[model samples]
Target chain A: MSIRARIDALFPRLASEQQFPTQGQTIFVDLERQEVRRAWIPHRVVTQLLGGRGVNMFLLHNLLDEALEPIHPEVPLIFGTGILTSMVPSASRGNVTSWSPESRVLMDSNAGDYFPSFMKLNGIDHLVLYGKAPKWTLLHFEGDQPKFVDAAPFMGLDNIDLRAKIANDFSGVEGKDYGLAAITTAGENLVLCSGIMAGPKAIYARGGPGAKMGALNLKAVLIQGRSADLSTARPHKLRNRDVAVKLLNTSVVKNALKKRGTPFLYKPSRMLGAMGTKNNQETTWTDKLDAENIDPYRPGMEGCFACPVNCRPLNDMSVLGESGVGSRESETPAVDHVAATPDTRQPTPIPDKYVKGDGPEYVTLGKFGPNVGITEVTQVLRLNNICNDLGLDTASTGSAISWAMELYQRGMITREQTQIDLEWGNYETIERLLFMTAKREGFGDVIADSSQAVATGKYPRESLDYLMAVKGLTQSDPHDARILKAFALGLAVATRGMDHLRNRVTLEINAKINDSPDFKAELYGGPVSAEPNSYEGKETAVRRCENIYAVGDSVGMCRFTTKLFNSPSLPGYEEFADQVANVTGIELTNEAIDHIGLNVMGVERLINAKLGITRADDTLPKRWFEEAIGVGPYKGEKIDRGEFDKMLSRFYAISNLTEEGVPKPEWREELEGVLTA
Target chain B: MLQTESRVTVRLPEPLREGRGDVITMNATSLGDIIAELDLADDRDELFNFAVNGDLVLHGEKDVALKYGDEVEIVVAFAGG
Candidate 1:
């Protein structure tokens, strides 16, 4: 039998006494052709690949003819959720994927909120959007059938307004009746940093997949499914369901999440000096961004669909700013502006109390604050809200603006070219620049396109290093590799580029909090050190973390939960595999689940490998390698080039790849069925 | 287990105070020893993540030696993407 046939044969029958939804189907919509088709994903493929990101990538790799230009109308964009999504214990995540306009590479982003569960409830596991909509279009699913409505009326509206409008159109519906995923005018204009916003403050905001959606003229997607919730299948799995339930019910993280939300990170991150200051010229700061400082403005906290860990904190900056009437804690920023007026010259000063949303997550906090030299938490909240309204990836947007400020300070760009004084920590210029970037106006246009902004032809060679990006994605998860070797390695080698979540070594990071060399040794399967800067055995730890996280992400669980990568004592294979068995009615061993993770990452690596990604791409920016971090305990620390190369080779080995970072031929050959399917 | 002889000073974050004063005393020698003795309720023992003077006893260290100084700073440890 062919390798594909053998793989399929292994999963021919459910590996349990109970049964699963083996007939999950795909909804294929051709926007350009204005047609739709439905097909069932073979049961074996579903079982082997699992779902969410893994399944989406599996289908996308097979369906593509060639790599489309990032904004090409024919780019296949997959919006998908997994088998156990919204089942319980923080599993309400969905993933979106396409060729990233930002990095010009294979792209995928995951978000936790309302959309994933609805997709599952609607019996729609995946939506492979093909071709382009001839006009502005809305894909609305009320039941099993989807209605393609004209999005003209909602065109040019920000994500929040557009979603509210769509929700209003489906009035008198139950509270859980529907969820929306939308793009703003930035997306409409094909801005590289545009992101799709879902739920309240939940955004799939990476890699400019939103631009792909807008390029197809697709606007809002309002989704609702009428099936019973996943509770129907919750009684089948053996062992530890009660223990899992108990952990979810009484976890301190969940309790703290209910109270402080993510805002709790504000002080600790700063205190540890694990922060990016002034675009990484410094990695620590003394500023007014502590939890005590911002608590008065915090009204409440929220959780995503079915999540008991209500960890999203609401930041009410409107109380401190222009206090607009619509600045209610739950509102998505502005209500005064419905459809955007297209005159770019008119600057919209952030109105009093204009910012009302949840979370100044460490991402937004790090990128917008000390990284860009803005210390005021109030402005960071407003900036975060503006990014939401304008449909910007806060990471990319903040990095781009910070990149520009560094150039301005160094006199790389004259005031004549900028038409404004580009100074660090200047809120006025920063605020105006944000609006302009969304509108793609003037200096904002230059700043918005960061890759173009720093191309050697446009600037000096030194400027490229200062951009603080790896593989074209800018940095700021507040992790500094100069002090944290694993962080540096992760930034260099993460498939998504410069992100900590993908493969960040979290297991040993907390070792310094007390001193658990024994547990650290157990986790690493070798003698382990508590030092963050130690290069010894970091690759093995990173690889282990990558595999665990890969499994968790594919299965639609949040990293912050009691799943794979949070605290060590939370649920791991025993609970997660059991939960899957209960929900899908297919028994899974711990090893089987781990194999799925390894298989999924191998597939993802090959997809990028086909894009010519290699060890050359698996590297940190020039600054991390050449410049020593200015402050913190490991001051003047930098990743030695030889050390990094050794780390990369070890990581590649762990991932079962060539030294160049390509998947071995056997793994690629195994995917021959998927490639040709 | 609160041995008055070898008692080490403990400094807890506000959320982990759990009715104990900010600066309390622990008789245990390691974070795990002290943590294992605390209640398994939502807020009490669950938040014993790290110790300042203990060098580095991070999540699930279960046993890392702690020494008495001015205080061994302990913080509520959590991580996110």
Candidate 2:
């Protein structure tokens, strides 16, 4: 049978009666042809893939030509909603999938509440954008027909402004709903770090989707629907209201996410010594935390559709500057790092006053702050805002900029070539480069090429020595390989280059707080210090973490809430499977759920393997072994290369991979079948 | 001759809050000596320099002497992203 026929057959055989309407809509738009094609994705396939992110990944893997570079224009841009999206209380998530320009691998971002509701109400469970538009066009999905409208006037607005205009344009149009995901000038410019914003606060902010759109000259696609059938009430009634209520009333879910937003990882991460400091330095801050503005307790806590815990803090920024822009609050460890620096812009007898805002989330703060040698919070925020407006990925942009600064300071690069005088804590020069990079003007163009490209003999390779990135993706935070051995190994081997979010094995070493201390100690060995240095059981911890994270991503839930709030251990595998079965009405098992998670991870691995990724690409920088932190708790310590190799060997052993850490052909076969068919 | 020892005050982590009652007081002739006297072995290496009377202590061949009523603060490097 053909691939499509096989996919069609698997649907009814696998799905429950109520999981999907027999005739649910699938809309495909050909921008070149300016034609719309509609079909039905049977309920079985949706149930097997678990809808939304899971389904999107499966489809993209099958349809895309091969493991093409993430930035290739031929790769399909998929916008999909999950089984839980329109109905379940906590099911407001939409998944966007494409080959990532930043990581150079398949990248996906989940936007909550807005995208899912809008897509579902428009009678589309999946919307695929393939081929480039001849001109800038708006994709309007109303009822069963998809229309193409000119989007010239709405081209250059920022997220806030674009959302307002789109709302007004579609206000009285029959059958549409609230929320829009639109690209900004950053996308139009095709900067590799751009993103798309959905609604006001929800953003698909990673891996350069905006740049991809810019390359295609496809401005924006607005998804809106007013079909009351898209209401949350539908899925709630199907799953039995008790299940939805139980999820909301779970106290464990509420308390954990309230205070820190996602940076709650700070305390445990600090203890493990994984927290990035002074650009991955050995020291940690020891002082009383500012208690007044802890995030969760702050007013106007907001959450996704049905979630009880509103983890996002609302900051009334009327107090900040004349812009009167109030920001939704979040925190990152970089805030303190940046805050510690003295502002260079101030005159003699410099005033202590500085700009402060919600966060320097871990990724941006780490790269812009310690990584760049500027510890001033105001400077970090300025850099953060500049990158955001320019549509740059803060992590990659900051790491690249900081690497350039370090290279200049070390005499590796000439001042004439850099244009700006580079120095640590020099905000003026850094600010100028941020603008230049966004415009890809002069020296900024060189910086925009990323550290990997620079390392290719464009500059002295010695300068790339200090750059802490892998596979083109810079490390989100500095982690000592000697300390968190498992996380180190995981980072080295992660398919999407060096990333913390893809595989967080560090949690296993620091699992005590997630569970009871006594139990974790017994499982891993003696009570490991909050530090990630102890090698004992590090491999096992990392393996478990990778599997759980993979499952969370495939299921279309945010990893923060899934791992932290709703732990895999909370309801056991069987109970978790039952929850899926109850929600999608597909009788699944603990083993089957595991298979699905492993399948998603395996497909990603296959893509990388086809691209010839191997143990060579999995290595950390040589500087990690040679350089020692100048001061603090681990001042003299360096990661032992021998220990890292041993850890990798053990990790491969546990994961059923070869000595080179490659998954076996049998493993690939199992996963490929699920993804392709 | 009347004898007196130089004093340094150290802030404690929250868990150690009860014992210090605010800031712990210690006595020695210099910043290094005062930190050693506290018996805080784990935190001993963290003190990079001292802030005496709100000014940073600078590197010099001769150790600076502390005087009565002079406020001394020791700064330690801590981890954050």
Candidate 3:
């Protein structure tokens, strides 16, 4: 098809004011029947839901049947691009939505880079799959035409090798490069904690979407298309430059991200007495994992497509041991310190050549480092690399391992149950457990689904109190929330369980914002919203943070590029509306945008309600309230139950939900109208 | 009036280092005094969250008194990841 013909075919309902397709066509695939279908994203839905995560939630709420199992053939698996995707800078996000096989709740995992943009270039906004393939299959779209090929040869390959092999095979095919969303050996083996590898550094690395894809017998989704031509979008030169300049000048972007990537946050986190240490029994540890110490391991930095802030670090594997700076030859003694046993495990050979990969983000660093009692930066990097290549969610994997280690420390779990001695900071044992978990081998099956799975029936009732999880999903944020009321509340009530990407009020730490009471009231509905430890105004803060984050996720904007992450000068709700107007000629007031965010939350609640989640599930783990933080400047800090309950009630009232945390019937009916229309 | 001689080591974030190393020694009785001594007390509330010997001292608690050889870390509020 000609380019114009293809565009017309894909976006039949394209609006006149739109210089380019804003919300492109939806492609539905029936893997069982090998059938393909297409439809335009209705204008009404676009206006209300605003595509990406919002539209994904809308579609899933209307189409998904809760009776079906998470990996059932009839269950819908959806991938969608945000409305602003490919039309603006740092807006390359694509969302993968489905019922999580791990968390057993509605899950939306998002990432950025070439994949979403490539999907748009091929004239697709959302791709929904139903039913299962007969065998392991690769779904390849060659310039908007779909093909199914045998994927037998690609099975069991690690993520890096898998991408390389596919690229090598498709190297000279009409000189077109392919965009891949693939899984590795972990997913192929149906590991419950596996994630979908989207790009070099972007992974849909939560909620086990990879296992769902594996269950569908879908090995990979590949898109081959011509490079995107920027002229059609008619991007404003001065506005783009202005945004670029603002980002470049931001102190956090310049000093923290541009210097050492996300891992730089590790020191601050430790200093705040917030970093979760030794399975959260403490909040600080050895300073060996400090950002300055890890400087030599970082070769350079990179960024997502069109993102000026290159927050991703390229870690050099060559600088990990005896040959590198700050090498700890004495620390590598082949003996288990806790068990006092000779370490019989053989060391994996380091590559002689210089090797590099993206990672050791703050979450991964903390989860693998202090939380598990492994203070060595090299060990954390090694574990992170293994997870990336094996298609495992690093946060969940680290949480599970740490929980087991704590159990072992208490003499609750013996070597007989674990088969291997579960000692704190034993890198070899941790490594072995990771492999075993990915393959679901032997005792690995007991804990592969995360600590929630391990606690139920397998462990004693008291053990349930110690598993730091909400609604089956383990907490991903490394910062201890007990001292920070806002963070604590956010973790308790986030839609996708304990993950911070959902609704964290990160600005609570900024003492300067507290001085501007007017701004605080406008954003968070109260004058005193910025205090971290205060119960006053916390409910409003959490509610407002969730709403704005909903807008960010829906518009395909990175949280790092917005006020949601750090910089106050970046785009907020008002600026976002302006951006939408500039890109698509869609004039929406900031209030309307905020309403859209509220509607997104409503739709998500409806979906979760169907899955039997309610106010009871919106609570912190027992440990947060029962046990005070044993160490830290914030010693004796614990969540006050009465205060937390009052906060929840206030949040529910503001969200137009009932005291039970369910959306009222009228709001639900209104949201249902948006979904069905 | 008798005066207390308080000596402490202060650690600052990269940007706030200002050609000085990450760690610097100062003699001050309180966090406010330290901030003033370092010439950082002017309109820099957002840039700091002070901690003395790993204990958090909030904006309201800047009057938190210091002692001899206390290690103070000027923790930045914004942790980007």
* Candidate with best TM-score: 3
* Candidate 2 lDDT, A1-677, residue by residue in tens: 33233334434433332333322355556676676655555454544455666677766665565534555556767777755454544556777777777666566666764666567656667776666678887776665466788889888675545666776788842113555666777677666656666545565666666776665566666665555244331243644355444443433343334433443333333333444554454434322122222332234556655554565544332243312111111121111222322333332212222222334344565566556665444455556555544556676677677677667767888878776677765666666676566666677667666654453355775666777777656765544454555567777877677766666653433222223445445433335233345555666666655665555554445554443222323222343455455554566676676556555555666666655666677777666677764543344556788877787777777776767556677775655555544
Please give, for residues A1-677, the per-residue lDDT of candidate 1 as tens digits.
32223223423322222225422457777777677666656646555677888788777666544444666766678898866676656778878987777887677888877877778777777787866788899888776577889988998787666767766777723228876788888888777777888765788887787777888889877777556334544574234446446556544465455666555554445555566777777777654776556677788877788776677878785465433222122232322232332122223334432357767676787777787787777777777777777778888888888878888888888899898777878765777787787777878787667654655255666778687877777774765557777778877888877777787765445543215566556664455446677787788777777777777777777777644254556666676687777777667787778777777777777777776677799888787888886654456788899988997898788778887787778876766555444
Ranking by lDDT: 3, 1, 2
lDDT of each: 0.68, 0.54, 0.74
Clashes of each: 19, 28, 0
> Chain B alone: TM-score in each candidate?
0.61, 0.50, 0.79
| Tens-digit lDDT track of model 3 for A151-243 | 998988877778878887877322136567887777877777888888766788778888888888888888898433434333455566666
What would you estimate as the lDDT of candidate 3?
Answer: 0.74
Whose DockQ is higher: candidate 1's or candidate 2's?
1
DockQ of candidate 1 compared with the true complex: 0.21
Evaluate fnat for each of the predicted models and list the values in order: 0.21, 0.02, 0.30
By DockQ, the better pick of 1 and 3 is 3
Each candidate's TM vs. the true structure?
0.86, 0.75, 0.90
Ranking by DockQ: 3, 1, 2
Clashing pairs in 3: none
The stretch of ten residues in a row with the least summed lDDT in candidate 1 chain B is B39-48
Instruction: Report the error of model 3 at residue B44, Å.
Output: 7.5
